[model samples]
Target: MPKPSSISEKPHRSNTSEESCAQRPHQIVIVGGGIAGLEIASNLPKRTGRTSIAVTLIDREPAYVWKPMLHTIAAGTSDVSQQETSYVAQARNRRFVFEPGELKGIDRQGRKVYLSPTEIAGRRVLPERAIDYDTLILAIGSAANDFGTPGVREHCLMIDSRSQAMNFNREVMARILETVTARNTLNIAVVGGGATGVELAAELIQLADVSAYYGAAGLRDQINVTLIESGPNLLGAFPDRVAIAARGRLEELGVTVLTGARVVAAEADCFRLADGRQVSAELKVWAAGVKGADACAKFEGLELTRNNQIVVTPTLQTTVDSRIFAVGDCSSLPVGDAGKPLPPAAQVAHQQASHLIRHLPRWLRGKELPTFTFRDFGSIVSLGGYGAYGSLGQFGLFTGGFLRGRVAQLGHILLYRSYQSQLHGFWRGGLIWLADMINSRVRPRIRIPD
Candidate 1:
């Protein structure tokens, strides 16, 4: 309703405490509070006299926003306030201690992790500290891998975090306003044919349509979206027909799809391809691939992949240490006798977290950990109003077929809600869902970032 504020403003902390547990309970330290870490902390049994462990979750951010929803955030179609899970509040409610800091290094022999100083509002908020653990879990998640492309770090935008998504929305809004003022078109280039890139391109068109409906009619016809992919088709992981359907859907929505296009370099306003094609745009987004956080490479003597993902065993334990476990996109563990690591998806992390929940406590009790397995279940690709498509099974024993239109979209929403319900109790989750539905009706359809 008012002019949007900058998301770069220091995040406000809430319900935070710096004190450690008084009792000498077995310390279970969790680094990185993404989906896996949050679920693991929430699902842990409440501390009673019976239990003798204290769970501590550490992360750089004060809140956790679902990574999959970043596209909608970038498009200004969703407000983050209702979605972001506050780490401090979650810790208080779930009986875990929350520490905000970036991982500096790990001492494998000492069973401790060093955290860099945490700064807020241009001042030292939390000083450098060390936390010890009987068992440690690393679920720090992954970041966008520019893959040595020139000028990419400076020129390309990535929607990998809440702040990044908010910044992207601001950029999109600024571009739209400029286009409206100039009565000209604004071209956007999105690299990668993966789900993020495809979903983002589609969501931007929806943003244009929403802007047109709400007094930005002059800018509706001025937004041009170009999707570039190095692969042969969109959604390369999906079946050929499904990928074709996704590409066709985007094309039907006026998106320019360039398949088999390799981006060799990124410039301020243009990207040079391997085939000598240079694509010009006002804004460029890189969402092709991901690697573990930069700090993963500094984990003492931990084994890591070329992309910096920690090498882990089938039980999700790091190859170098059994006490330390990695999950989500940051850890590379083999799957299905394929000699390849598990796919980077939230579902994989979710299932893995659930498996750890069953085994982690016992693992601390001298029980041997069992090998972890994953179920494919299926993959769903959203195309906004154009439609959604998904396959039921490609990896697991369960076989499934393609789902289209509302059915697929409904599945997408339901899956997200179920995740919320899993974290919060059914009653509270239902109330939160109702609140979101009500907010959609009461608030503006398109919201600028803060």
Candidate 2:
């Protein structure tokens, strides 16, 4: 992240029809184009003849990729180019302004946000600019929190973003190649037994199988993966049966599962456990917890939680400034768990974003914003190509049931497709799904990077 730039410049005012755009309450800036931000911008009207609201979405990256698919990218099972959607095209088609820059700070009193210059490949792309908005929405999602453990950040890789996940894939492939050439065993340690870690461990095994198919036979026997969970069970959020099944599946795939194994610290090529045991590995990954970006602390005066997540009310409005809102992994809103903040999940953010599409227009009319309620549709944890488990509950309905196998796996894929459908509409989303299917059968194994 860059330092906060000057806020002397103001955003351009809207000069559209008076009925469609308001002059004073003109710009509505949305920071972060993750699942939440993109959905809101796509659903919100670009121009309602009856009102004025100029929408602007700013993010450090120029594209959006579903966060859950990051593990696949990390395992070399998916391509980043195929998974990413161009933000500029989305903005142009959806009727919003797209600004590419990293958010550094916010001027709450002045109603403006400071965006630092955008850089790519060590080259400057977009210069710093100030975006003034009567209403600002922060959807800047989270990153993997290492809990300040010694050597965690220095030694472990995380799959919290597209780039990091891709980097992990490259590293894994490079290590596998090294082991193949040296005729040695490759050890891998995935910390935090959460959904991401579990999925990643399983996917790595599947990736090894694919590598064998691509002329790297005997790679599987040379690769060893360990999944470490501090909790008593994997997928602690899911039912015990789901956890048992997931652990069983991983074990069947030859993954070493370590429960109640808390990592006190990470050293180069090894992790020190709380019980004084050490787990050695050639590669380590941290997927333990979620926390807001450290850069968000520079937002100046907004109320934030210990994790640096913006503290928001039930309506997703920032506690300190009603004009500013937050959702997704970046928000800490007291919605459930005895006034504790809601879990930072994709579903939570999706529901909140949907609620605003209906309520934002009312907000512009000076009417009361309706409260939001989150209904969990359960969860699905896919164990690579072997199987998936968990439960699915209907949205706003009275039906729920446990699921497994292909149905569960398809359910996971459907959840991602639902988001794509929401963004690109049904026709395009359907086509993309078809294309993915075709590519799966027709495309050969991915080529590992050097």
Candidate 3:
């Protein structure tokens, strides 16, 4: 292995389009190429008059995937290839730079971030390089929290990223086929009753139906799905009635909903409950909880919460440094409800991104920084394509049954489209939407490789 480059070192030139840009303008480095980071790069008031800030968006992956749709990918309802936006392409179009590298460490005093070199097939493709920034924005998302359970890291699957979701989808299909061929029962254990867990459980049920239709035998009856929640009810964040209804729906689908059951240990083939009960499962999915990216907590001199999230003030600036702002799942900011930190949801991230876009330009010009107040617009958890349940605004809990569920589905689809509109202009977004609609009708529902 070669020695890593320092933060001040320049990257070796390649034929890549990102490297072809001649000017090395004043920098505003945005970490994590997720929704929040991409939005910030896209909407950063294109450097006017005396103010010119060249935005450099960095991430481990080369492309940006809308994470809210990961559950759909796990269900084989959405193809990752179709949904992902190439960060390099987007940066070129939007007049920014895109660096595909994993964040290794940060030097706040030096205003620089050390990035690990990217490699492929045991060959170094991109050398370690760093870009100096006047302003640093951390939008790196959270990861599935294992809670230090034994064998979880070695055995369970987490649906945090697009690749993980796709891998799980493939594993699920393969498991269904294997069980069908062997004419044996296949059990799935989902740990966590939050929105992602509940939504994925519902989607897995749908996938079973799809598999049975596509000639995967014994799937309809032999498939056993179990949901384990530490709380007394699923969707604990929602109203009691909503939680009750969701649990009822899960039970109706023949899923074993185990409430107030915590997994103390996990093995390759099974998990041990806190109460000394053992659940046998061929495949395990852990959606239990989330913590900020491990790298975020490692940033030098940054204040972090108990959950390893960056401690940010009301204006979303890091407690140790005003030049650094942390948002999305990586930041811990005060919430109105429960007087605690808000849960890491796509809604909160979208709100933060929008808020920052509105006020960041003013702050960049030595003006007043806007305080971020997160308004609870409420949340809607999709129960696969069957239905959705949750509340809207301050209104009482609303349940979408059948036709209304489709409306909710449209709303969910529009949420990502709205993000796309922010990245690309509305006119271009409309064109993309039309193309996607036409392609959806023509293409197969699931991806098949030749």
Superposed Cα deviation of residue 10, candidate 3 (Å): 27
Between the candidate structures 1 and 3, which one is better when assessed by TM-score? 1
- Stretches of candidate 2 exceeding 4 Å from the true structure: 1-25, 46-49, 393-400
Residue lDDT tens for model 3, 119-211? 878999988886777678999999989988989999999988877887898987788767888889989999999988998888888777766
The TM-score that candidate 1 achieves is 0.92
Prediction 2 global C-alpha lDDT: 0.84
| Candidate 3 accuracy as TM-score | 0.89
Candidate 1 lDDT over residue span 66-132, tens digit each: 8888899888888878788899998887888999999999877666799999998999989999998
Clashes of each: 0, 5, 0
Q: Stretches of candidate 1 above 4 Å error? A: 1-23, 47-49, 395-398
Residue runs of model 3 more than 4 Å from their true location after superposition: 1-25, 45-50, 336-339, 395-404, 448-450
TM-score of 2: 0.92
After superposition on all C-alphas, the RMSD of every candidate to the true structure, in Å, is: 8.8, 5.1, 6.8
